[model samples]
Target: MTQTVPRASATATPADALAAGIGFLRREQDRAGWWKGELATNVTMDAEDLLLRHFLGILTPQAAEESARWIRSQQRADGTWATFPGGPADLSTTVEAFVALRLAGDPADAPWLTPSAEFIRDQGGIEAARVFTRIWLALVGQWSWDDLPNLPPELVFLPSWFPLNVYDFACWARQTIVPLTVVSTLRPVRPLPFDVAELRTGKRPPKTRTPWTWDGMFQNLDTALHAYAKLPFNPIRKAALKQAAEWILARQEADGSWGGIQPPWVYSILALHLLGYPLDHPAVKAGIAGLDGFTIREETDQGWLRRLEACQSPVWDTALAMTALLDAGVSAGDEMLVRATDWLLGEEIRVPGDWTVRRPSLAPGGFAFEFANDGYPDTDDTAEVVLALRRMGKPDHLRIRGAVDRSVAWLEGMQSRDGGWGAFDADNTQVLTTKLSFCDFGAVIDPPSADVTAHVVEMLAAEGKTGTRECRRGVQWLLDHQEDDGSWFGRWGANYVYGTGAVVPALTAAGIPRSSPRVRRAVRWLAEHQNADGGWGEDLRSYRDREWAGRGDSTPSQTAWALLALLAAGERESEVVTRGVEWLCARQRPDGGWDEDKHTGTGFPGDFYLSYHLYRVVFPLSALGRYVRGGS
Candidate 1:
């Protein structure tokens, strides 16, 4: 929707901004008692969605044309597509975008294809692309399974105690690799309408040295596994394949998705289909139905539109939206807040998941990222949900009370050995796993992170768990992990601005004095980093380079994050706070919200970025309200 705000007089205060932003947010809330904004990522999702539909023989001309239009419009003037906007051209994204366009009937001699294909050839061609891309190519007979790394289904049988077991992978990666094992073992290849040979460099890529470095060792292992597959089908191999099939079936979420993310849901469908599950089978049918929910269609200001979220974030979005509304002084027990509480309570996971392998005694009591994904209830979302419930001030409400108690217990159990919390599992910080076998993209293990841990600490403090041992330990962990520049590392969000934003507030809630040296240092870091335009922003590149941390074009979401941090640190009356609030007010549209073009959310650091559409609106509202109320 087009967002516009009333013109502010020279005497306009943060109060005026808060009212405008809140009004805009209230209008945008869904009728279902929750909010769900666009979770935008790269064009790869568009390209991959088309590829999956083609593989299943369900691609429609309309669907193809709509997706192709989105993909083509995203291409840079130089004819290369980037993984994130304004970032360098990525060969993998370019290749995928080019192939999707070709399938959509774009001519081989099309202006974009010529340069994109040349870019692919210049970047070492198909052989140099990431493993996941190569795997996708293999499915359509464009690349050979033999050229890809090996992922044995037998790995499914590895015990939790064993190194490199299936449980060692983060929940998302596990869901993806398990079903993938079936696809690679069967080696099924469905040829595409066109070949991409012209995109390839004539020469073969070099092999890793046999002596075995980190990546080289995996390469050698893959070579040995390849040779073993050629010998014969062993009884053990057949049993492993069966185990994999059952494993896939067992984790399917009640909403019909696997892991609540696109990668696994699509792969699971393909894997089950190859295992003889027909289109009409209940599991296959449900999986197909779930995919439709992730799709989004709307009319952009530029005209027609088509896109797919890499994943949904209803639970996460609802929790934050409720919190932002309440923080902006939405009445406690307000009908909308009450309804959101009911929906959140209904979504809680009652069954144990892979997390049980680590915390065997803990009862299930957390929330997932999407509407489904019972198998992976994340700590980040759980913490935020608990805080949102607390914000309602309904301690006497039985359902809210029950949920808070159970979720708090679950969060405590999920905490790592170091007193910090990882998003999914405890002690899942085995860094060596990243170099082992067929894992090349994104974080492989769920390790303890400062940002996630801080949220839990903040939640605990709010519940009067501040003096408790667990809370104290969590507070210390945050201090121990603080960077020299007084910033914390953002594991789930973008850069130092996100890390500092998250940690300072939690620390303040945990009884850290605003005058304390550490807190003061953090407040200073934020003040110093404010952009020339009186706002704050940080690029995804900060994940890789320390110098880029807390530096970028001003954005509403990141600006709000900074504003909240300053307020939490007792700097509400400071010049930086005033300037930050003014920046948000100046950018507000007539409809009472803000517009952001930069990708502020982080998925896999430099490899992936997100533009949370509601973030630009909700956060600024929350920040402005807190400023008007006189404290965080």
Candidate 2:
């Protein structure tokens, strides 16, 4: 059921709400000059943290109990856990959560355990779980390693020019696959305290049909690889293993994570340990400490519970916060704004990373999503940081001018042949990587996305380069990709609302008339989709099902996204804009922040999602600020 706030008269006006928001943001800023909110995801992060600890023989009783408390609280009444709130129960997530509870000392006959086991059986038991889940089971000796797809360490030897080379995979996938290759080859197993036979059905899983296509070919390749694994040894395998270990070690960030992400961080530790690195080794120890930093322990109404973030977002959050405060009319010279701008300038990445493979000669100038992911500075963060700096208007500061120039050049150099931009690399849209049987889970490749492209276009326009060849090409890409209903797909956020919100502003700023057919059509779509209570939202399901596009219970962040696009298209006087502004003002919390539980941020579209806790504040503040400013 869609949630609706009563349409009572809003007690706050746009100006009043904007002031409250600005004050709220100022209070939240770090003394060091950035603002970072919690990045929340599913229970898999907590579950996986426990599993890693268990494998490392460091699963303390107190830690297991605390994490289990959080995991159990997330279970649905139907005795299953969903990847996102109100989403369908996921077979893999439920399987992992159940096993984590068992490790936490829950008895097999416990009330919670029995129903979850039953749900697992009804959902095809362990056989139906995702490849990653099965791999986890295999690590704990609950499943056979032979049934899982093989990822040979020799993949590290493939040159950049070769198909399916490590670079062909998305940066996140590449970081994970490299370390995973080492683990798969070692095939280490740790014994579980108890068997989970009750969770399994009595019948063997049926073989899936693989037609004569890319998937079929990869399936055949996997079979051949398994046959090869059965050999006593291959002379080249030792060299491949050594090379893979070196590659993993070389990429460990200063914070002791590979790419500042959970999957690669844990897998890299396991890979190194299996290859004979002890727990106390500097690299291994640092990786463990890094994960400890990602842990979040809080006192809930039920009790003290612990959860883990899949990744951190200090750089991304700070950039958006700066933009929001600027939109709210904070002076650039204000102490807080000046501090944030200086901090962002210091965080600028000057070293080349994996992106250099495609743009070997382009000078490095970008920003990473985390505190220290120097190996993978993303274009999305770089774009947003540039925009915020430009908005701050420090034209006389040589440092700021040089940073913006280098970033704009870097962004232009990273453009793909399609005239669009992916988050990490240029031309990283290889379909074969996603087709690999080993990649049956989340996205394995980073393709150009509408949201990322629109941000770049808007950034370029703000830099007064709207007519540059690169900028024009990006605008054309957005025009070509517009959906039939006038919305665009948001690969990095919730469906069409995020995409349309981003594109309309970029188009208008790039000198496309507000009266253009495309702009008017988008305005019509936003007006048509407004909820009865006067807001907007789109479910994560929109990625997989068209019916859910631009339709869901209203959320502050999503509603703000819609309002931004409408206002950009000269809808400041429209009733749609009025109601959206009112919805934001009516819902502002006592502290000026907004309460949002829905996962509007996208990780892998339908397969994975994120709830950026700051989205609720930053987006609405930006929209309300512009609304009060007569849409600028």
Candidate 3:
């Protein structure tokens, strides 16, 4: 069932580009029959890895030097590090990187530290950093524990129905904050190698006098919590800490990661170590070893460099790559695809995790982003994997049928009451916890998003489930959420480009005609926003400001996304389509793949961004293959 139709009157066949990209992707596939391109994030991960090692008293001289080298290499010309490349200088990232480099024995008087020190001080210094940054400072005895907002371990006692309960958080933040509660309660501080006075702005932050707002109320609440922390031991404190530890231990994946992400894995290990779990404890040892797998080392122009990734993305990359390959005419029955399907089938989650709390009666049947993480299976990844399976053209295969049916059922049950889908849980949209001062970084709750919902709807439509009530509800949600300008919000991806691109084709496949007024409006929006370079791009800033969405210097991946949307709307013969295709062709490298330095994959919108190395290559291939296939 591989698509092979070629468009007539084409300036040139995208077959060459598609074939070359496919061959490159084929070589990139692992021996286990899956693909995993590097999931690159910012220097914060590398800096934090060194900081974690320092806290555990296990940092080797060799390892420290290499990590410092990598951190220093990421420094921008203004001598500050950012959360993402080509983004603004981030105060928190600069502070962490500076502290890490100083711990690596980079001299206090080194010229490289001067500009960064100035940047931090001018930006309001260490006190102006995020709550998470302040927590790290407190860990190394650089900041006092009293300065941090309180997160009582007693929070473990809160039932699911209680306000600000653990279940209110998005899975990623929930895992990180749970252990943080334990750490904040213990308030352990290790001696530092040196003071960070040079990074300080020398100005005390003015206390807020406004009493009616989120900041004011959270400030008062934190004051009360802090007072409680100093009171005579309550009997529940012991039981609460014990509950927190047990909660963490129970969620450890088979690979030893808490949630297959850096923050939770690192914090959980630290929290346990403080509770007298030695470095060699089974859980502690496994957690540390699991983190090592996320490190990437390679030869750089300056020499060998080792960087740490915030998380791994095997299941995600494999699904996207498989679909792209099929679009490029790889036979559905190809041995490679069969092997991939077998691998994916083996990965289906049968045991419930945190997601079960939201949908207690829902059956276990979804996939996690990592090889482990059985505790949290995301709807986004599960939907994409189903699409990949369908693209493999195996309708009657027993294993595929079973996995798809279970996943579809899970998706149906996990849909938000709003008729959309969130990343992990059902109806996980509590805005109260996000108002807390400690949650100053990003969205703490996982609300239903346009992009994830679109993928699920698209998958169901492919399976002929569009006639069902569940699919109809999902379609309605997408229509309801469309922006005034016809774009949709991409909660998981970059911005409007990712969301609108995902929604158009999904709606088309779900029985909405491509020429429908709503669909045509979306098509017009994309056409009007096309960059002068004939491609499309969006900045990470778009997540913070609506004006920035669907606007930036052209990138291969975003261009491909727009092209796919246009193709879905029957615009394959349009001028915009040809120009977009040309833009991608002109940008392909001699390696038979595209070169995109922009970080297209979004981890947490404005706070964290990802440059999935394969996205630049994989998505472009899919676009070209579809172009050769005539249209979606």
Candidate 4:
């Protein structure tokens, strides 16, 4: 699931660019004939999926209408929406808008419909929808599911330790595939529980690009996964499925959901339903109702950002914001710090999760992304937040500071000996378990990504805790990871750009010299990659496409990172520095905001991207805030 992005792939045309992107994606499809990447998990997808079901008679007309009413009510005024502030009008959003309008019974001229449709059409029409979207169509027989890569129900056979086994798949995929195996094998089109015949154009678009066959290694390896999938399952495989089901079911939280994420929830719904749970069963009903709660409402002059799903990251967000503001040179004890700190205090996660299993030696409590995500957030944010607070030049409220200490202690115990930190727990390093033929995921079991480990290192240094045995190990790990190009891979951000940006500053803070070869090489990398527009960008493709090498259109946040790296290296007058700074100034929203745009936020590099609306503002502000202060 993890990949080191290489250089850009050459594409003579936009058509070629997209063709290559999709083609590259196509090859990743499983033998199950299903293509699932990061599960898009946004409100738009949920909303539109409901609408599609309704329009196509898969759900009741009344249900469809009700959902459409809810969706229509969430739009903003600017005729466009960025999932995050100053972000872009996601094609997924546009597609959802179109389908929702159809459910609303809007005539073709419906004011919003026209603009939304235009946007959808412009973004490559139906074809532009992600492979997952197409997979949905294939399910309804609107598109051919056969066209899907074969997903034999038999992958149920592989043992966890074997290469290509189910454990190789991330936790998310593990939950989904168990059920998907049933669905694909059964391949039954449940009766439309409502009418959606009106939305389609009635034809698949003409072939637009060349087939995307790579060095053909994947093409061949794919054969093994597919072959194993076809093999008969012994009792062991059946028992594995039983274990997987129980595992998934037991993990479902009190509200009847799993993963604090939508994709898993959706699949859980499908899985249980197939397991003979009726539509009205309590678990099924709860799962269905949970979908309704996953929406957000923000009316503005610009278009509404009906985020595919509401954020489940309050704890994560609050912690990161506190840390980011502090990094921006904000004085400690400022109102922002106290407010964020207070929020973090109240939001500590008090339960155990997968991290607990991977590290039974650690304590039971862990944090979640949001106060609600009580599922995953454990060490990453907590560790970083502790670092942020420990370094603050302010007094913490007694109660809050104590909570921070508990959090930090937990992180210290969670550190891997290499000094690099994994996000949730320590010693969870069983990558071999998930690489089986049954696995189909981007999340590795416990691999330490550079971005995350670097954040931990920076946090330690900020607290003047660097050079300790553990911290030094983390530093060495970072040093070891530096690419020949000087950039390390960013695990949480885009790709190399984000990794390099973070690595350089942390190393410098640890007292790595500006002239150190590592620092100079990173500086050169940043300088060389700086865009003409003064900003920086690495496409989502960087997650899966080494050729794209994480390079792409410039955005404020990426530009800021580039600037931050160069700035840390004391590259004040570097030509790259000037252009990057200028780009930020020019792109500033008149309201002192940057576009709620620029895909700097990282999801699993390729399958999903984030519109960190705040990035447009927070980062630009950080860079600008520090820069305009008379060059420090």
Candidate 5:
């Protein structure tokens, strides 16, 4: 006997919702045949942009006000800015936003400023913010440079085999750290026009003793680095600075940004400037211009607002859109799909990048998340890109086959020794790197994740390599890492629901039976966690607190994620899945899309979150299409 599922009355039928979603995607497609949604993060992007302009001495009053308008709009009623929607107040984000507002000429004693300043003091003031936040304040003379940790440029000269070498850090952290070593060594301080004393409590937080621990050891190391910074004559330091500058310059992308992300982009400009590169220098000029490209400007009810994307996701979004379209019954031979396939083929990376530091002999062939991050083609994007290409039944078979072959070889070579795939470099799991006092923010190392590994396993299985040793090992790895409650942790998405969703389909594709204990447990977990409204959602807090796992208000993308797993697990006729389908149909907008203000993507797990605007449409369309087709 099948379990009964309660039905909710929906304005649109599943078929109607699918058609509307497909049409919405078609209308949103670019002339070049791709789709990209707005990648929204917290106010730090806007706050940091203002500070960068002030440091470069190019901040226009209009620009400041525009950015400030956007920043001010993000503040919560408590006068604090959380990293994500409905999350707790973040001291660092609140501090950064308050200072940026002050820089925009918001009077310190003003009604809005008073609440923010009070909140900062209550949270232990500027002294309690993260290292990166303090580093930003130090740049502007608001915080003493001496109080911060020192990162020597000499660390760049460490051999690859040595512990804590530059390559040991994640690609994102590596990019930011190299230039920061120079900035810390030069220690430039451009004083702000006004003081932020109101945001400080004037009393230092008490320190705890832990002489035998990793934190204690790294703290001692930082003390030595500080002493080294005070030296008058150090011949090796001069050579290290030269080498570090060259390292930064060599890695600059074609668009003049480093790694196509904000941290590195901003720090590289500052480091180069201190190393005597004039503002007019081509590298510096292009760097500034590239940032303007990342800037999103729009007219709102309040006023014209400006904000920045920490990174872009054109290739990632385009690949996902293609897969969604195919799942929604769009013909593979459609001109729209052919154009997308062609564009993806053109974007493939065929040359060496930083990943080669470890796999030096491995040939390069993969896709990156952004438009021009050739230096870092990730496994996640490459896996999905291959899956999309394999689905297209167009006339460009030979070309697509060659690219797919290269990507398979590249991905296999990039797998970690533990038989799993990380987004970037393989075996980049140095625990000591995260223990460093200077590395006290977001993930600093790329480690194999269940979600990424699941995609690779699914792609390989789709290619008929299910019996290969690599595929078998990846399957075992996923089995070995499931949570006690039957879910997997999603390193790149929101908590357990995302992880379980990605894994269930991949396991079934790789030949795991729906009746397998692991699959059934995951299915039960999803069904048990269903929201009262018949949809699914998981909070970003699940990354930090287990109590929140698979719990939150319903979201379109997350609900679709759950449905995809159930549909793949042979649950097409189950009441639980029927309810999920009905929930999506009832929520469909007239234009065929859904409204989702909450972030469904993860950047740094607990520290950062992302809102992929396209997710609300693409995912639901795929789910509803599969449902209407009776799980295909």
Candidate 6:
């Protein structure tokens, strides 16, 4: 079983003057409409996948080609890839690139390909490739026979209510996993007449007993799942698989995507092909073709920078940008704020997602998306938008205010019995699902996470939810969630630093006194956690290492987060503040941004992390601009 990590010590609260500073921030928002910048998913992983396709001479459109190239160009000389700069290189990503470049027609003897293959061999060669990577390799017969886990396309034959039912995985995983089940069962490895000398594992892997064990990480689970394929099954299972395939087809998003994510698309396309469907198959063709839209093309000095088919969430972006602008002293009716409000208004989620499961009574009209995420249902967007609008000058800015109020009402109604909020669903108490061996994940349901709940608390507090039963409940929830060391677990951000930063402002905004015992402890944690460079950063590894929970090798965006949290906690003249500001200013790139190589956000603990492109700009500008103007 997984365990929550230890928290850091909470510090003493500061004097009352801190209230004025927070008020300055809250008061500057546009009439309670929420907004936040979109976070880009793991670029390294996402990019390498695109490059692999390109390397195969698949020849994506010009834009996608450039993006894939750009991603490949960023590959460090070490022949390894990382989600963020200077972080540990991931094996799966490296292997993906090695194969992609080889497909791009680069000879294995090429200078770059040599080191890349060497690195892969050193890391266990083809044996170490992730199941997903192996599946891709199997597509082209790059790997040998009998080595892959058997996922007979016949699984299209299983029922919904069974133990390994189709819907058991999280929505994100389900989309990809469902299709893969079909593809693997068929086991169609395309003929690779060309040399794959670099990809050989040097030997076939040994078979194993007891394939089920969470102790082995995601890879071990792959081995186990493959082992289960050898077992016998009954006739009743045959009908269920058909139902699942039908369900999969029916739920395809309007944009030809499932859950607005890529993995499912790739897997689904492969699976359909294995199911006797050709390239002309409607679902297969649309699925393969839709990815082109997600590519982001950027021209670089070296040819072009290529990207993959991933989403872009602008609705969330506008909301967060508005908040940053407001905090920087832009008042009511500010041009930027108005434009942001308009953008957010256009981006609201009118149709509910699976979140409606916990909230049957609430209407489907809520959620926000960055332009990229397009139509995936989400909660943080609505919550943050509420905070943004509530801070606007006109108490009666009808349109934005109406949306905020409606969103607030919807958000309030969705709160779980636990007194906190979840991102997509509530009362996700199906803990039994997590206990299953195939479930190599943390939680299936979107339970009340620290980040989502804090966003709700922050929004409601801005809209004068202060001291109300809801406010108190939310505040108490945060207080209750705090670890003995005084920090809360940041379900969404990288580590405790994110949890701590979010809660301090929320509690303070909800009328918690500057000196409240709870408030005091959170502040002290931030003050004490500052790095020697007068900045703050927490490694993504902190998700695993409790001791280094909120520690990172100082960066601008993180420093801004720490400073913002400290300022919210009423520490104006603290030495940490001066040093944070100095670090940001000193490191500001000529393009008016900071180089944030650290992954400040989490996707799934130990599975993925995000390097938000805008976090470097907006968060620092909000903090630095405020400090420049005599912020607390």
- Pairs of colliding residues, candidate 2: none
Error of 4 at 350 (Å): 3.1
Candidate 3: which pairs clash? none
lDDT at 221, model 4: 51
Task: Name the regions of candidate 6 deviating beyond 4 angstroms.
Answer: 1-72, 143-168, 193-242, 272-289, 372-375, 393-396, 429-445, 466-470, 589-591, 625-632
Q: For candidate 5, write residues 1-632 as lDDT tens digits.
A: 02223333356899888888888988998988878898999999889889989999989999899999999888899888999988898999999999999999999898887888888899899998999999999999999888888899998999989999999999999999999999999988999999998888888645734868888777778888999888999999999999999999998899889998999999999999999998999999999999999999999999999999988888988999898888888899988899999999999999899999899999989999998888999999999999999988659998999999999999989999999999999999998899888887899999999999999999999999999989999999999999988999998888799999899999999999999999999999999999878899888888899999999889889999999999989999999998899888888888888888789899888898999999999889888888887653
Clash count, one per candidate: 6, 0, 0, 55, 0, 54
Each prediction's whole-model lDDT (CA): 0.85, 0.91, 0.87, 0.58, 0.90, 0.64
For TM-score, the strongest prediction is 2
TM-score of 1: 0.96
- RMSD (Cα, Å) for all candidates, in order, is 2.5, 1.4, 3.8, 11.7, 2.6, 7.1
lDDT of 1 by residue, 1-632 (tens): 11233334445567777777668767777777777888889898899888988998889998898888888889999999987777779988888898889988999889878998888999999878888888888988999899888888988999998988888888888899899989998899878988999888877767586655777777788899888777675888888889999999999987789987888889999999999899899999999888788788777766566888888788888898888888788887777788788788888888899999999999999898888888889999999999998766564478888888999999988888898999999999877778865677788888888889999999999999999888999999999999998888887777788888899999999999989999999998988889877888887778778888888888889899999889999888888998888888887877777888888887776688888888898888888888888768
Tens digits of per-residue lDDT for model 2 on 248-329? 9999999999999899999999999999999999999999999989999999788789999998899999999998888888
Worst 10 residues of 5 by lDDT: 1-10
Across 1-632, the per-residue lDDT of candidate 3 in tens digits comes to 01122232234347778877878987888888878888898888988888899899899887888888899888999888988878999999999999999999987778999999999999899999999999999999998899898999888789999999999999999899989999999999986778989888767766864779878888888889999888896778888999999998998888989889888899999989988899999999999998888888878787778898888888998999888888878888887787788788888999988888889999899898998889999999999999998666564487788889899999999999999999999999999988988998877999999999999999999999999998999999999999999999888778899999899989999999987988998999999889877889888898888888788878878888898889989999999999899878766766677777788888888899988888888788888988888759
Ten residues in a row with the worst lDDT in model 4?
A: 1-10
Sorted by TM-score, highest first, which candidate order results? Answer: 2, 5, 3, 1, 6, 4
Per-residue lDDT of candidate 6, residues 530-626 (tens digit): 7776678888777777877877787666777777778888777778777666666666643354566567867777656666666766677677656
lDDT of 3 at 241: 91
Task: Residues 391-442, candidate 4: write the lDDT tens digits.
Answer: 5544555765666666655666678766677765565466554433223324
Per-candidate TM equals 0.96, 0.98, 0.97, 0.69, 0.98, 0.81
Better of 2 and 6 by TM-score: 2
